[model samples]
Target chain A: MPDYLAGIDIGSTMTKVVIMDNGIISSVMGPTGPEQRRLANKVMEEALRRVNLSFKEITYLVATGYGRINVPFADKQITEITCHAKGAAHFFAEARTIIDIGGQDSKAIKIQDGRPIDFVMNDKCAAGTGRYLEVTADALGIPIEKMGPTALGAKNPAQISNICTVFAEQEVVARLAEGVPLDDLVAGILESLASRISRMVNRLKVEKELVITGGGAKNVGLVTALSEKLGCTARVPPEPLLTGAVGAALLGKDMVGKALKQGLPLEKKERSLREISLY
Target chain B: MAEEQKKEERKKRKTATEAASKIGGMVKAAIGGTVRAKEEGKKLAYSFIVCSYDEIIRAMDIVPVWTENYAGICGAKRDAQRFLERAESLGFSRSLCTYALCGLGFDQWREELGEMPPDAPWGGQARPDMMLSSGQILCDPRNKWYQAAQQFMPDVPIYDVGLPWPMYEDDIEVSEIQDYYIAYIVAELRGLVKFLEEQTGRNMDYDRLSDLVDLGEKTWNLIWETYELRRSVPTPMGTGDAMNTMVPMVFMLGTQEGYDFFAELNRELKEKIAKGEGVVPDEKYRLLWGGGLPSWFALTDFNYFNSKGAVFPVETTYRMIEPTYRLNIPDTDDPIERLAWRWLGYWTYWFDKAKKRPGSEPDVERLIQYIEDYQIDGVVMHEAFSCRTWHLGLIWQLNQLKKIYKPIPVLVLGAGDKKSLEHRELPSLILESDIVDISSYSEVDTRARIDAFIETLESTKKSKADQQ
Candidate 1:
């Protein structure tokens, strides 16, 4: 039997699970619907199946993300801030900053040695997150997955002054009525997003060896614009969306190691993973 | 959803209800105060919080109605949206301060109806005879809210007091600059006196004003002494109670009633501490409610921390008032001059202290002082989006504190052996919410964040104890 460490990230819009068995990693992702409990269990089962393991075989598991507390089977729960730091450190050990643009919020996390030194998150607004791209893509009649590549081909991007999604929608509609091309509008929206990300990054005054994670990292156009805006190369992990989940597993591993080294009595049942901490 | 959390929230609601009951009486009396003033043909003047004009108004026989307090009433009752929407309907932006919007809307509606609006919170806020607005460097809303309200009642005159201060600098002579700064603000307070005398057909009585000023000064000292008593282990009161008890300090500052309340409060707190009674049992972690205005609707969240065995020993919020004793007042026969010195003194209390310490910023220095004095293990702050004066510098302050402050020991596990060290800055949690807008707050998210932070404190405690 192989010992395993698992992490489930139940984000606002998506859920991703990652499990590691002796350095062999497997992960899965899906849309997070109205039911967080169901989503969390489904992602965990799917990730476990991919790793050729049963739930009981996993030695440690940590749950994280926005709906972190809702995961019933999670042995522990941690904040995405610390998890992202751990994941970014796994990707680039020297990563000084991590810029994560999730479905609902954007954050700039200052990282040092797989730990968060300082962080600042966008106040509750849909202005500079993945939702902005989804909304703009829908309004432009472009697929959400295709908004990135399409934005890269723009020759003249239409300017959008509104940082708010509602106002930005009005601006796009007005531009469309004035005969502005769709591609330019898309490019402009992505550019505006890049600017917002740069502002949060600048707030921490840390620009060296940056990593972009979450669903935003998959967007080539955003990556390009963000790199230029940041004036440095931004690295995306092998699996950008799995960073948070991977970070969760890393913490689980550390928790198990620490617990064992302390000579603490471990749970006897094969079905129990042994609780360390819930948060 | 756990039974513990529900029971904790229930315990919180009990205290919240008590606070609410007290607020209801205050609001009703203050509103009825307006009605009575109208019946008696007395003048009513509107003002903002911390403007330090309550004593002056009281001495001049003018009724002081605080607009910000009314906005908070609407918030605590969850009845602010109607007035907020009305303000927005009048071409005011929703992005503007909710308190200002609520006040402007309530003012416009009351003036239009020639009475309080239907089902107004606590019989609605009173219409002012004149308005005293502060254009302080702190809050832009203070400068604008009354000005906008005055537009609704054109006959009502407005006096704007610009209480500006020098933001701390390394390259300037602060004391000499402060001397000039104090003079300008003194002139402004005197101008308010002149304006009030004209608004009410009455002459200024200097002696009575001095007495009132003395009462106000004593109240500040009393509140400070009362607040300081919380430094005891298992603090007798958390910032939640402070938010309620501060009603007098903010609104009734110059009154003997305010002084009496503090006297009773200090006596009760001392008794509680002597008896070893605290906000909670088995208090594990002491936290500093560091900065920013609290979410009026969700103040009970403070009690949620209490449920987790975390007691707030100190807060650098609106309640951690500038001690009246710290102000250097020049020998002056005029109480008005002393009032000016007191106003500047409160605003600049941390500046001199901050400048004296190495690598110390004002706000961070205060946090350090508080953490030491209060035996604080962590810091918690509310990031109220609506107010820039208190909210903007918060992140920077936390960042600086983390950079400069050294970690204090919790407890060593093995006294004679190599112990585990929980080395680093004190953990800080920033909860984001609006001061008045309930919609901006999510109980689930906030509760989860706080729960996690408490766990962090617990882990730090355990780590320190487990050191070998």
Candidate 2:
């Protein structure tokens, strides 16, 4: 039987899973809810079913992201920063910088030879994260998906000087009351978020070519604003949300390969792909 | 949900060395000693550390209430919140140094009740007869904290002494400004002596002062020799233990106990090194705690690093004792003159070397030197939000280090149409939190950042091994 490797990423806002056999056989993602254990199990089962594989057939599994410790059926766990660098480099091998804007926090990782050498992350604040956009979008009474397209039509973006999300919402509402266009307001918010993220990414000196990943990369407006702020074009993966899961699966594949080469037995958990009721 | 998110109690750290566990008792006794000194009609003076006045105070038979040490004790005990809130209520902004604010709050409450604050750490800091605030180049809080506290006790007089040094200049030689710096520091030390004489009605005992200064210098040399042993491959001790060891080095400067403690620690470390012991059982990475003051509440963060196979053999903070043998000083019979010379010598020891290197300051140069000497794999710095004295300019130092030390090569366009290699810096992590304010810290977020940093270190190591 071939080595069937699996990777699961239980992020703060989303859960993803990928199964690999030389290449990706299947991948699945969904919103992360209050119950992480249940959601991780559900996502992993869906990915395995797509590839017609059972839990016992999987050679090794690696879990990653914020809720990585919640996954009980994994051989080992690694941080999302490492996994994202690996997954992003898999797509763009020449990329030296990786900007990941996730739900709770954002980070900039410097990649060297397909491995992360250094990284800088946002402090304990939600001002420069996807959650900030979600909060502002909710206040604007606009769908999060439509905020991007709405921003693309702006003639002159409104100015938002507040760094606090609550104060920024007040600025948005005050600007709306003054008859500013909705498109301008949305565009201004995304631009402001882009500036915050670019400042953090600049700490790593911003080497080319850069790849933007995570749930936030799905927004074309943010990608445009960030690229303009960085003064370089950024490449986004085909499925931005799946890079972490893909990276996890890739790392698991390497573990299996290394063990096989060294003639050593791989250490793995005795996992049954069933829902754990601990949580 | 908010209640669950708020964790007031911190994780208890596991110390690697036996000497570190005894620091708590040392702190408690020191605090209690001041209170007993007051009851016995002995004069008490409020003093700050690194002021270079501990030996002089001991010579004058005056008890020093180390206000900063008490503030740190309050922070480590997790009882500083109420005092901090009191300071805020008195119109002190939270943006100011929390150590100063905590002491000022306790002073006001003590004056109002004419006793210790309720449930104060170690029976609260004793009320002082006078305040000795040092006007130094670093730490504006040292000059202002006691004066602010003195407002609550109008009877206590404040003595402000200027202990300025000539700022480093490329063109200026140490000899050009050494005399002036020493003259100013000597005058400051004599003025401090006069202030103590007037307060306590004691005559200047030159012989005792000279002997005390001698002990202080001997202790300083012992400290340097002991800590330098951390260069051992496994690093028998780490900075987590140094946080405890610093108590004697800073607080008990002229006393024989301070010198004896280092002698004992030196023996313990040597024994451990001989037996092939380390702070971590399997020390994979040796890190430098390069800059900024530590989070007094979350010192267990060091243990957290230890759990990940990272051991900090050397740190720039609180390890203020440098080798005296490396200095060139004029022979002086006066104890005060020697004290002044040593002060200037310690601060400017790295000046000549720092000036020789391009894009390198004294702090950065010291970091690079320690990195080479200790075989450090990565650098970790804490940025205490309230302390601009130590925390400011750290980023610039790190940037300069990266610009100068290019170890990792990446391709760049050369003079012709060919690609050449340009190097980058070693991996680093900066943890942001306040020194005393627990409310500003989140253990979960800090741990996540640490986890990411360790992953970077691992990948960097793997790539290096691959290249070799």
**What Cα-based lDDT does every candidate model obtain?**
0.80, 0.87
| Candidate 1 residue-wise lDDT, A40-159, digit = tens | 677777877886788878888888888776466787778888788889899899898899989988788876556665566764678889989888877877788887888888999889
| Candidate 1 local lDDT, B1-468, one digit each (tens) | 356534543443334223323644665687778768877888888888788677789999898888888898788777787898899899999878889988988888998898889988877787778888888777898888877887899998899988776687755556878879877888898899899888887889999999998888888888899889999988888888777777878888788877887888888888888999888878999999899888887877888888888888788776636676688877788998888888877767788778776666777888888988998888888888788888888888887877644334433455667575445447778899888888889887687667657755665555446542
Candidate 1, superposed: residue stretches over 4 Å from native: A35-39, A139-143, A147-158, A166-186, A265-279, B1-28, B164-183, B282-286, B307-310, B357-364, B376-383, B395-399, B406-429, B445-468
Worst 10 residues of 2 chain A by lDDT: A270-279
Model 2 Cα lDDT, one tens digit per residue, B268-368: 99999999999999999899998888889888999999999999999999998887776665677899998888889888888888888865677778898
lDDT of 2 by residue, A46-131 (tens): 88888888888888899998888756789988898999999999999998999999998999998877788788888578998998
DockQ of 2: 0.67
True contacts kept of each: 0.04, 0.77
Candidate 2: segments with Cα more than 4 A from true spot: A36-38, A274-279, B1-11, B407-425
lDDT of 1 at B241: 77
